[model samples]
Target chain A: MSNDKEWKRKLLRDMVVIRTFEETADKLTLRGKVAGGMHNSSGQEAVAVGTMSALDPKDVIATTHRSHHHTLAKGMDPKLVMAELFAKATGCSKGRGASMHLADVDNGNFGGNGIVGAGVGIAMGAAMGIKQLGHKKVSVGFVGDGGMNTGRTWEAINMAVVNKLPFICLVDNNQYAVETFIDRVTGGRDIAKRGAGFGLPSFTIDGQDVLKVNRYVKEARDRALAGEGPTLINALTYRYYGHNVGEKGQYRTQEEIADWRDNRDPIDRFSAQLISEGLLSQDEYVALHAEVTAQINAAVEFAEQSPYPDLSTIYEDVDSGLLGAKS
Target chain B: MSTQTETTRNTLPSYSEAFQQGVREEMYRNESIFILGTDLIERGGHFAQVRGIAQEFGLERVKDSPISEAAMVASGIGAGMYGCHPIIDLNFIDFSLGAMDEIINQAAKIRFMFGKPVPLVIRATSGVALGGAHHCNSLEVLFAHTPGLSVAVPSRAYDVKGLIKTALRAPDPVIFLMHKKLSGVRGEVGDENVLIPFGSAHTVQSGKDAAIITYGYTVVTAQKAAAKLAESGVSIEIIDLRTLYPLDEDAINETVKKFGRVVVADEAPLYGSITGDIASTATEENFKYLKGPIVRVGGIRAPISAHPQSAEAAIPTVESMINAVKKVLAY
Candidate 1:
């Protein structure tokens, strides 16, 4: 990684922002401030932050429904994201899409998909376009462990390999696709081993470690740009909350949640590592948390003050204008 | 701005050849345009709709994909969002059922949800021609019901060339359906630069009596029925609605106001068809001008069989349209 102190501090701040932002959104959703269902990615911040830090500004990424972390990590404005959650006119998508469908194409984030494994094919297509345009950019797609079993995902992987496109499939294996455990559907097989069937290099890594995640993704992006084809990385992580905010179920125990939150929290471990390396001090860490929480409060205030889209403009943007205008 | 050869413009081309020429001309004009589907590279397409595209534009533009309909359509949308404009070819319209989620939920709603322009086209051969249930289906109504998609069902060779050109140049997603039965039928075509705008209906035949409004292969059936009615001294007018989504309501209103009697025909099943929309438009907009009930002629609500006679009976026949016009006229 980089020896620059600012870069290290920025990484820590980024993860903290994602964590605070999601927790705030969850609280707002429960109080009926937000519009739609919010998928929390609080404990899985390292996977999004670390992997995204390795990408170039020109490189693109397609994400799944639980995407607040990825959207922010790709450099989207937090104010616009929070405004979208509130269904304001100034949202990233002009309030047309809420949390589950955030997108900023100019920022190289292709938006999140509600359907399982749908974003994978879309990312592969972007990779194909990049290859056809002769650009040195790699396309990354994030999927859950359950998304690996989808027929569409397999087809995308196979087609990407056949075309030799620059692509990366990042699996945030959180061990659960909703209430169903990954082992029940995957038959206890390693998600990384499944990549061998497609004839590409794959690896299983500790996603809790931000430095390792960053290094692995950087190598994959390098291979893709060198025309060496695609790579699949299974980043093992966990979610602190339920599948969705305020979900009512007994599938996971309180002890299990405590285990991940207290023992394997990505932000806590990374901060500890930073302190050990003398890159940060306990006093600085506390101050950083306060700064990020304040930033998130400002974003929420911006979303609250923003206005909803006018009813008269409902018919706008239905199409991109008619064809054969002059003829 | 066109690379069309003189030979292609002078002669009357078949529907398939006209479609191929339209794609070729568009690719020559737009470098970002590419065609992807099964059997497109060496085998040219299932119906030869893009025969020489691979040889002309090379492998990068003319891609032959595996039998993955969902991936093909999803990737096309992605490519369209990026820099490339893609034409995803589903060999048969019936095969589009496999990728309904990608087409309906993703491609059709991407622009509305994400506020990004998806400049893409999905070309598929529709209508029944004795093919099995897996091959023959008139599912244009399914796409017509969608909000962010434009559905184009062109009938003759002239329309095949003109409508495809319009679809290629369209800034939004378009579902361009070419009838399977009209692939080999030859007709007069305009110059290579001709483009027919969507929501514009072509008045095929004019008369003072009842009118028959339809599109796609059914337009040919309506013409035959009108010709037969002409011999019997019943002059039935015909209006061909080339595009379904951006419907030509003005033409339908004019036809309703002038004739005061109408018959709407479609190849899709009777319930929840395009005919319902046309009939509703006539009653809602021009109800007072109606001299009689607006009859709707459509196919049977069942799967088209492989048997030639059974398949023929499943769709709207010339006799069915003739009876529909007579019923409206006799009122």
Candidate 2:
């Protein structure tokens, strides 16, 4: 484990990089450079960063559609991720998968599934595979508040508990699923308690605090690796943007968004904590922000310059052709 | 002669037993292979297709999942993504509707999207057999329509054993559809490493007269119809397409050109059915060689009845195939 100063700096760097990348992606989408609409994790950075920080390089993770932060935090190359969003040939999925389907399997980031709550089973299976292979790696599945309503989530949770799979179910409760507030649709508002109902150790944490998120996730990971089965962590966060990029977000008032951004912004809270502890100076924070901005701008340039996949390559990778169907 | 007949009789097994034997053989060959589904470990599945597998492979390998088809399939996909080969037993084909997203979107598209091979097999029981709309369905067309999926509909014990083994070893995902009514149907299955490849069709009977093409349990009906038509001096040819998606277009073309008249039969609903796909392919490719329009014998466009008689009447019967053959010959 890193010291307090190193941890604060690393957390701050990850959060800023996520924020910068998302902001750049938003601009790119608006300008028609990015084909698919973007789902920015603007206010929900701390959850992804903290949870990912607790994971080892060998541990696998599966994310939801709003997955840029998770993908970046899981250590996927920013250049390749940006290229994928641009539909370039040099992308991670060879330009086949767009924003919602970013995956770096070699790096242990299984995928960013477009379907809600679908990753729960995938992560559970990965954990099962690890156990079968006699490895101690734990798999983490990230789902949104809306994903909890899906039947597959409960099924996966039950299976993980019964089988003693080393898995972690992270619920990012941003309080909404697309347009509707979660409470309006969900039978109950307490997302973390639902995990306990499935007979697993679970917790609800303040998602705006990166340190708290990191500590709780580390505990879960340790318990999982120690053969205690799965853990469900509900990170209470908020999305600053609408469900997608361009909407005005009329479902919730501007005041609510403003209150969250001002009083509960994860980046702001983390920055303040670092400054209060004398870990990061104001000058150092500004320089780090500038550095992340420059790095994101370079990634945008790389994506813009990257060539689109040739039309002839369209039929490639449909199947591995190991069984002799078209390659 | 009596001793030889007894030896031949001992070699034959029911469709379900052949399928179980195939799974057992593959599990023995590949240590990574495992089975999981709703009543697999406890009761050996609703159709008893996996009836003594849990005892042989142990409960750890033959897992009994919850009534969660989506998670079951998704977990299979995840396991397949890694180095494990999973054979997911979806009890009834109709129940696959609950897990279509995982089947069609995830399992079918994962390999294509990620450029990684997911070697998995989905064994689903299909066809109407004294069951209602929810229990009985031949929904292989839905899977065949998807690009990345390979579909296999085996009729006899011999074909099911070979096809199921092949599916387990295939590089991509395979949907193995077994007819529910044909579980008791017995056929001679040789004790050999018989692995049938997909995209190949079996010419059950050859003739110069009109041809009848079909798959699944309907192949049995088609063959029976051909035998009846033969009694009437009509030498109707029978072609059983084992796989649906990578259809043996060459076989369809060869039979259509030789016979000049054709009848396509399937157990699925008429609209957007596999039979329609076969008919369309035959007409499009063998239009110039056609002496008559291609006809389709399939299930009616209504909910399957729960009653036995009506349920049997819902899908194509031997009489329907025979009538279709005669109608095509007349045309």
Using lDDT as the measure, which candidate wins? 1
For candidate 1, write residues B36-125 as lDDT tens digits. 899999899978898888998899899999898988887788888887889999899888888888899888888888888888899999
Q: CA lDDT of each candidate?
A: 0.88, 0.86
- Residue B103 accuracy (lDDT) in model 1: 91
lDDT of model 1 at position B11: 64
Per-residue lDDT, model 1, residue B205, is: 82
lDDT of 1 by residue, A81-118 (tens): 99998989999988888988899987778889899998
Clash pairs (backbone) in predicted model 1: none
- Work out candidate 2's RMSD over C-alphas: 2.0
DockQ (C-alpha) of model 2?
A: 0.55
